[model samples]
Target: MLYLCIVNQTASQNAEEFGFHAGDIVQQWLWDDDVDDSICTKIEDLTGEDLVDEDYGTAVDGVVIWWRDGDDEDTLADTIVDATTMLEDNGPVWVLAPKPGRPGAASSSTVQSAAKTAGMNAATPLTVSKDWNGIRLRAFGKGR
Candidate 1:
């Protein structure tokens, strides 16, 4: 016997494009930062998951860390550590930063290095929103 599964093309496309999965428990680590509601709504619409805004409160399937250039490295590192602890096994963490040439934009290298320090591996870059780009990284001790 053979079986076929049908999926929504548009949802699948959005998932692939945004690096989000349906039912994922996404924690938006804002660090007291403000993000446009439209961006948050778009993510929810695409992934069918509710965004959680908390400080390392619960285990999550995915995490979106909002960062800015000129932010303190030590503070960022501490947040990364906390995020790693709260992430579910094999969960991905995306570091969202301002796009290059934008005010308070962090370089790609900086994000990559931070991921490395957190014992995560950078997988791919994603354009998450109009004002922010993301670097997707996998948590340590899990195989993709």
Candidate 2:
């Protein structure tokens, strides 16, 4: 599945770095200084033409942004590519999942329950693959 990851460039440093964002789709390693509260407004203020249809929300470290454009593979791919490019070049990307009870933290149960919350019917317990950078995208299914 194609995913878009919007981030702050100044904090991420450079495009080649593939900076970490808390809610980023790619899931990369992260550090202590990557956390920030104002990530949403920053993403909203981004002056890019490609960011037109982006739906903005709040994630662990920064803003959660996604596109609502029609189901076009090329368009989705292009947007994801651009967003990642900007994430790396523009700022220090935060990819780490915040610990539970912390300011921007997400609980382990929440991560594990993604499938159930999404209405995926399964008989086994949800197992989340820890990427240590961001959330995991797991295949919805029943356990043995």
lDDT of each: 0.71, 0.30
After aligning candidate 2 to the native by TM-score, how far in Å is the CA of 74 from where it should be?
A: 30
Specify the highest-lDDT model's number. 1
The weakest ten consecutive residues by lDDT in model 1 span 1-10
Residue 8 in candidate 2, Cα distance off native in Å: 23
lDDT of 2 at 102: 43
* Alpha-carbon shift of residue 38 in model 2 (angstroms): 13
Candidate 2 wrong stretches, greater than 4 Å: 1-53, 56-97, 119-133, 141-144
TM-score of 1: 0.76
lDDT (Cα, tens digit) per residue for candidate 1, span 1-144: 122223444443355545567787788875445564666676787668789876547778777788889987666667777876877766667788888877788877777777778777766566666677878877665565
User: Best-fitting candidate, measured by TM-score?
Assistant: 1
Q: Write out the backbone clash pairs for model 1.
A: none
Candidate 1, lDDT over the whole model: 0.71
